[model samples]
Structure formats: structure tokens, C-alpha cells
Target: MIEQSRLVTPVLGFAGFSGSGKTTLLEAVIPHLKSSGLRVGLMKHSHHDIEPDKPTKDSYRLRYAGSDQLLLATSKRHMLFFEYRDNEERDPQLRECLAQLDHSRLDIVLVEGFRNETLPKIEIHRPSYVKPTLFPHDPHIIAVAYDQKPDALDEFNLPSLDLNQPSDIAGFIKHWLANAPESEKYLAYELKL
Candidate 1:
């Protein structure tokens, strides 16, 4: 049987400083998005190294035994691990990561930590943190989600979101998905120059 082609899906990102609650908001918003019949795929970028397979597990041992790539599969889910050379170890490109998702199963892709990438994103800001706001300089920031409105909020024309409410954020995402440009709705294979 021929493999099914991946669907073109919109990519939406959450961007913020480390403690600004990007993950927490996503944790809450995902279920809300899912409830509305969206199949969401997430791609995260991290500064630290990650080891999802335990040292004691066969998969980990096999990986250490020189497998360049490994897939751990079970009835419920699966995970793929790829080993990189020291020189090859660097922050992954957003387009490269986007290419990895099985898009046929997703309606949209939600991203975390690619704050600097040129993609449509919701800026999560906490006024109490006194951290610099990204919306001022990032044209890719389409909206701001905050616990309290920033003093500079009125200066911009962007929509503001209440960080404390996931349902409202989900509503905003649903609306965005509906209106996103066809160029932005497609996957990264088309993103490549």
C-alpha cells in the first residue's frame, strides 16, 4: 500500500522568557484545542540535552551500542531518537523539526521555545517579571497573552489574551487556524527555499 501523504497544517508558536509560563499555558490549552476536534503536533526547542530513554533500558543500550537512530514503539505511542556528532549538535532548525511530524494526523502544529524564529507566535508576558516584552521588536508576534496587561500594551495594535484562561486562548487559536494564510498553513517541505 502507498503511504498517505502528510497534510498541510498551520504552525503556531508560543514565545516567552524562561519563567513566563509558556509550557503551563500550552499544557492547559492543548486539551481545550483537542476538545474542539483539532489534532495538534508540538515541536519544542531546548538548550539542555535530553535523554528520554533510561540508561537501564535496552533501547538506551542499543543507542549507545552505535545505533544512529532508534525508534521505541509500543501500542500507545512511539518515540524516535537520533544521535548527533558533537559538531552536528546544535539548535535544530524550525523547518527541519517541522518536517519530522506526521502531519496527516494533525490539524495544526503548536511550537514552544523557538522564540527567535520567524513564525506567527503569541508572546507570553508576565508584568510582574519585569522582563522585556518581545512584541515591541518581533513583527512575528501576532498577540500577547499576559497575566496583567503590560504598561506598553496600548502602544501596539496586537490583540491581548488573558493568560489565566485557556479556553479563551484556545478560541483565539481556533480562529487563527481558520484565518491563517494558505502559505502559512502548509508544512515545511514547502518552507524550504
Candidate 2:
């Protein structure tokens, strides 16, 4: 999927079953990534309908009143709400979400779901979950980060990460970014000059 025409900026995914600590790892590593002078963008997928604006808020009322798209801009931040049409009830495509980001402003993009997509990802695993690992089935998985090394590791020869060390994971990510292939580094927008 990296070679696909839509690729814009380097993308790394954190994938695992629910309760595998994907969010926890990201929360811890994002600070390290930012501190190292990297601008990161994230695309997270949700199984449920999200109501970011409260029903009591004017924005929410306006959306329900027939506005298809609403942008709420404040001094500190801006939020956009897109009210999907009735016929558009479906999971968003990964490419569609990637296009929503301003690639020019981000050094890399971290995807939080879309585990079935063909992309390079770090598998977050917790042995206690008793869930089978994804790497054996997904060739796109480049490494495994775990709180405890799974017994299956003996059969797979992949890099193992200490889930407890966010700094180490950050370092690993930085290294991967530095060495990522040109095909995977396609940018959505390029400076002509």
C-alpha cells in the first residue's frame, strides 16, 4: 500500500486487538516524538458513531439542522465536523483519512486502526490477552512491542520491543523514519522550489 499513489508522508501503524495498549504506547511516545522535533499526525478509526460536539452546543444543533460540514475555529484550535449523508454509513477508507491530514505540516502519520490494511505496523501485544499474534499472518507487521514476550516469539524472527519503555520505542520509530524507503515516503504536497 505504500506504493499506492495516495501515499503522502511516512506512515506507521500501531495495531492490535482492543485492550492491547496501542493507545497507551502512543500517548507515551508522542511526547518523545514531538520533543525530537518531529511533527506527527494521527488517524484513528472508531467502530461507533462519534458525536464530538454536544447536542447542547450550537455547532451540533446547526449540523443537525442540515449543514453538511461545519468548522469551529477558536484561537487555540480548530475542529471540523462532517455530517455524513444517510447513504454513507460505512467505515472510512484508510486513504480517505490520510487525505484529511495536512501532510506538509507533519513529518509522519501514525495510524491507530485499520489493522487489515496493507501497511507497515508495529504490533502491540499482551500475552495475557491470549489473542493470537498478528505478525505471523500480516507480512506488513515490521516489529512487535509487548509487555511480555509471547511464547510464539521463538518461531518468529522479528525485532522485539519493550512496551514499558516509550523512549526506546520512540528511538526505534525515529530510526525507522530515517531509513524508510522512498516509496513509503511519498508526500502529498511538495515544495516546487
Candidate 3:
């Protein structure tokens, strides 16, 4: 039997400060997207150091032997490890990493950070954090997911979504994707531009 190819996969992003509800919103939306017959890919950006290779793992040994990147897969799981030089930044180029996704099988890629990228994003916010609203200044911010009413936010003209309502948020994403321009559809929107 021939394998079915995926339709266009739009990229969505979630951006917020530390302790904001970015992950919380993702936890809610991913399952809903999957249920709707869409295959989803996820990428998270982190500033901290990450050790993808444990000292005893074969992948680690390969990296220690001076391999630049290592790929490990089993029947159930797959992981990639890229060795970095000391003092180098840990994160890889977002676009380059995203390009490695199997677009043939994915309908969407939900990115959890990289606030500066030009993709449409839901800015998770909490009033107590007192951070400036991203939507006011950044046209790329498509919505705001907040935990409480932001009294200082009445002047902004963006959609304000409830952080706790994952179903509703999922509905919003579905609607947006359904209506998005054909040329604009796909994962890594900003990268395309």
C-alpha cells in the first residue's frame, strides 16, 4: 500500500516569559489537534544547558569520539544528538532544526519559544508577571492567552484568549488554520519569509 502524504502543515508558536503558561496551552491543544486528523510536530526552545547524551549511552560515546551529530532510533522512539564545543551556544538554528522534520507526515508544528521569529504566535501572559504585552508592539502575535483580566490591556486590539480554556483555544486554532491563506500555510512560516 502507498503511504499517504500529509497536507500543508502550518507552524504555530507559543511565546511567554518564564512561569508563563506556554507549556500549559500546548498540553491542552496538541491532543485536540491530533484528534482532528492532523499530525503534529513540536519544538521547544530552551536557554539552559541540556545533556542529550548520557555518558554511558552509545550516542554519547559516538559524540565523544568526535562525531558532530548522532541519530538514534528504535521501533518506538528516535533521538538526535549534536555535539557542541565548549563556550558555544547549545541551541541550533531554529530553521535548520525545523527543516529536519518529516513534513510528509505532519500537519502542523507547534513551537514553544523563539519569541523573535516571525510566525503567528499566542503570547501566554499573567498579569502578576507585569511584563509588557507583546501584541501591542509585535504584529506577528496573533493572540494573547492570559490567566486573568489584564486591566492595562484595554487599548490593544488583538484577540484575548483564556489560558485555562484549551478546548476553546484549539477551536480557535482550527478555525484559523481552516481559513488561512493557502500560500501562507505551512510549518515555519517565518522561515519561509
Candidate 4:
């Protein structure tokens, strides 16, 4: 499935433990990417439940009343809400959500928080303050975006980037996206979640 996805759109992931600058980096990278004329699609999985609906909205009321899927469309745009009716539906597979993205109109799909998914990912590392690095375990991680270079970096020989410079990271992403398919051979190393 991942091989099939690569033929259509390049998918990259930003993964790190909480407070390791994953979100901080993307906020800057997205604008740089957009300014560079690339149409980017982003998918983020939140550990916390989010409330995008207000209590007074009809969509909220309908969902609250037991609607499974509610799509509110307007002249400008539309929002589709998929309410998970079962325990299995509550958390969806990353591949399923990736398919839903309009890849034909996108240059790349940036995924956040789907660490367990089999894809090329930049592992954001902050050694001085952050927890242990994940690259030692996850082979899906292609490179490191860090605040300080740790000793383990030599062991892995993975490309490293400074976390403080988002532009550099963005450039790294552009380069990685261009060559992501070449790294597919490492897919055999993917750890089963």
C-alpha cells in the first residue's frame, strides 16, 4: 500500500515525544513550503479529543443527537465530520486517512503524530532536554532534526538538522521528499506496532 502511495504523492512525517518541537518546526516549515509554490496537505492525529463544534451549532446538535457522519457544505467550502460509532472506528489507521487526502492536487502530505505508521519520518531530537532518541528502535525514521548532536548520531549515520532553523529543516524535507521512494528498501526494518 505504501509503495502504491509513493506513486501518487510523497508522504513525510514529523515525529518526536511531547515538547520536542515537532509542532513548532512544522508551523514554520508549512509557510516556507507554501511560499515555495508547493501545495501541501497535512494530517495530524491528536492524543486529546478536540472540540471544533460549538454547542449552539446545528451540526453539533445533530452529531450530539446520534448522526454518524455530518457534512456541512456551503458556497465557500464544507466540513465533513465522521463520528466514530464503534471502538474500532474511534482511532483510524493512518493509511485510511492518507487515502482520503486529495493527493492529485498536492505536492506532498505531511503527517504529524502517526509515529507507528510505516513511512519516512524526520525524528526531531532535543538531547539536552528531551527524552531518549527513537531512532535506535524505529527504522522508519530517516533522519534527525535536533537541537544538539548526540553521540548516538555517529552510530546511526543518519542525516542531522538543527531544530532552531526551520528553514534548513524545510529544505531537508524538500530534499527528502524528492528521494523518499529510493529509501523504500528499508521498509523491511519497519517495527510492527
Task: Output the TM-score of candidate 4.
Answer: 0.85
**What are the per-residue Cα lDDT tens digits for candidate 1 across 10-74?**
88899999999999999999999999989989988889998887899999999999898888899
What's the CA error at residue 22 for candidate 2, in Å? 0.7
TM-score computed on alpha carbons, candidate 1: 0.91
In model 1, residue pairs whose N, Cα or C atoms come closer than 3 Å (at least 3 residues apart or on different chains), thus clashing, are none
The list of candidate 2 runs beyond 4 A from truth reads: 1-7, 185-193
Put down candidate 4 lDDT per residue, 106-185, tens digits, no spaces.
88888888887788889988887659998899998888999889779889989998888888888887777666565552
Summing lDDT over every window of 10 consecutive residues in candidate 4, give the lowest-scoring window: 184-193
Tens digit per residue, CA lDDT, model 3, 1-193: 3233333468888998888978877998888888888888999988887786679988777888998777899999888776676766656666666766777777778889998887788889998887877777777777788988666567776778898889888888888789977544554322221
Going through the candidates in order, what is the number of backbone clashes in each? 0, 0, 0, 0
The local distance difference test score of each candidate is 0.86, 0.85, 0.77, 0.79
TM-score of each model, paired residue for residue? 0.91, 0.89, 0.85, 0.85
Error of 2 at 21 (Å): 0.7
Question: After superposing candidate 3, which stretches have Cα over 4 Å from the reference?
Answer: 1-8, 152-154, 187-193
The residue pairs found clashing in candidate 3 are: none
Q: How good is model 3 by TM-score?
A: 0.85
Q: What is the lDDT of residue 58 in candidate 4?
A: 91
Instruction: Arrange candidates by lDDT, descending.
Output: 1, 2, 4, 3
Listing every candidate in turn, what is its Cα RMSD in Å to the true structure after a full C-alpha superposition? 3.3, 3.9, 4.8, 4.9
Which scores better on lDDT, 1 or 3? 1
At residue 122, what lDDT does model 3 achieve? 84
